[model samples]
Target: MKKFIPYILILIALGIFAGYYMYNKPHAETQGAKADITINPADLLAAFELDETKANAMYLDKIIEVKGKVKSINEVEQGGSISLDTGNEISSVICEFEHAASIDGVKVGDEVIIKGFCSGKLMDVILVRCSL
Candidate 1:
């Protein structure tokens, strides 16, 4: 027990340092980062709708560039989000920006390309850390 005391202390110190480092890790910048996959909103929705598991395997956690007409913009307490038309009537691709400035100049009916990290679908396919 005496011999192990120093090793245990060192392990505890390393654990604390690792926790602090993880807590302070910066978010990934999507604005200038290249996308892993690029697909239109309609097709992207269709893929998920047809086979959610396969879609999840392919798109989940990947940076995706989606091109479609802007359906709507929503401002919430956290930040602003944009819904892209998917022709599904009930579902759309929801792109979430960390700040409003990321979505500036975008409007409904405008054909645009947006990039984000896929977080899987609820009613709508959600993308986080989006950029124009």
Candidate 2:
């Protein structure tokens, strides 16, 4: 039993190391990557409104390029969020940029195309790691 103790301890240490490595792994670069889907923001919002679960299964973790008019902008710690009007009064596609300064030229009512990963949806469909 004493001889097996060291082996067990080594195994435990290795398991911990493996978990930490995976947990800290850097995310892949989404910038400059070709979008998997290009669609109007209004259409995208409609899909989510119709079927959120299905929309998430199809779009989540996938890069999408959306074109729309900016409705609002809000700065955050990580960067900022741009709400794009989706031809709807209630919902919009919210694109979260990594750096607020990166969206310097963007403003309300500007027509722009942005690409990002479709993370999920709340009151709005959420896109993260957005870039022009």
Candidate 3:
């Protein structure tokens, strides 16, 4: 009985350690998740008020999400695409999704929130996800 008691205690301790490890382990979706910081295009435009060239230079290859209205829908040989107005007075912001068909339900002039990673000056944003 005494020997069994020590074994039981060790097993219990190992079980607790396993539970804590599982509970604190990083999730696949959040392993490299970007910071939750967000900047509204309108506010960013108003604050920095950068021209297209400057804005392009600043936001290129950066991770950002912008909320705006859909200005138009376009279809190319590659795939469908949507343009978003960043509430910028100078130039409209554009976001292109690899699979534009996913956004088929969205139409011109619909308000939407878009999250993506910025690619370059062309506002070559990759739409990670979006919502109306």
The model with the greatest TM-score is: 1
lDDT of 1 by residue, 3-107 (tens): 999999999999999999999999987789999999999989899999999999999999999999999998767878999999878999999998987778888
Q: Give candidate 3 misplaced runs (Cα > 4 Å).
A: 1-37, 43-58, 87-90, 122-132
Which residue ranges in model 2 land beyond 4 Å of their true spot?
Answer: 1-25
Better lDDT candidate (1, 3): 1
The candidate that wins on lDDT is 1
Model 3 clash pairs?
Answer: none
**What is every candidate's alpha-carbon RMSD to the true fold?**
3.1, 3.6, 7.8
Model 3: weakest 10-residue lDDT segment is: 123-132
Cα-based TM-score, every candidate: 0.82, 0.79, 0.52
lDDT of 3 by residue, 1-132 (tens): 787998999999999999999999962331145634367655545433446567556654555667778877777555466677665544555565556675779889988776555544433333333322
Q: Model 1: which ten-residue window has the lowest total lDDT?
A: 71-80
Encode model 2's per-residue lDDT on 97-132: one tens digit a residue: 988887998889999999999998888899999998
| Residue 52 C-alpha lDDT in model 1 | 99
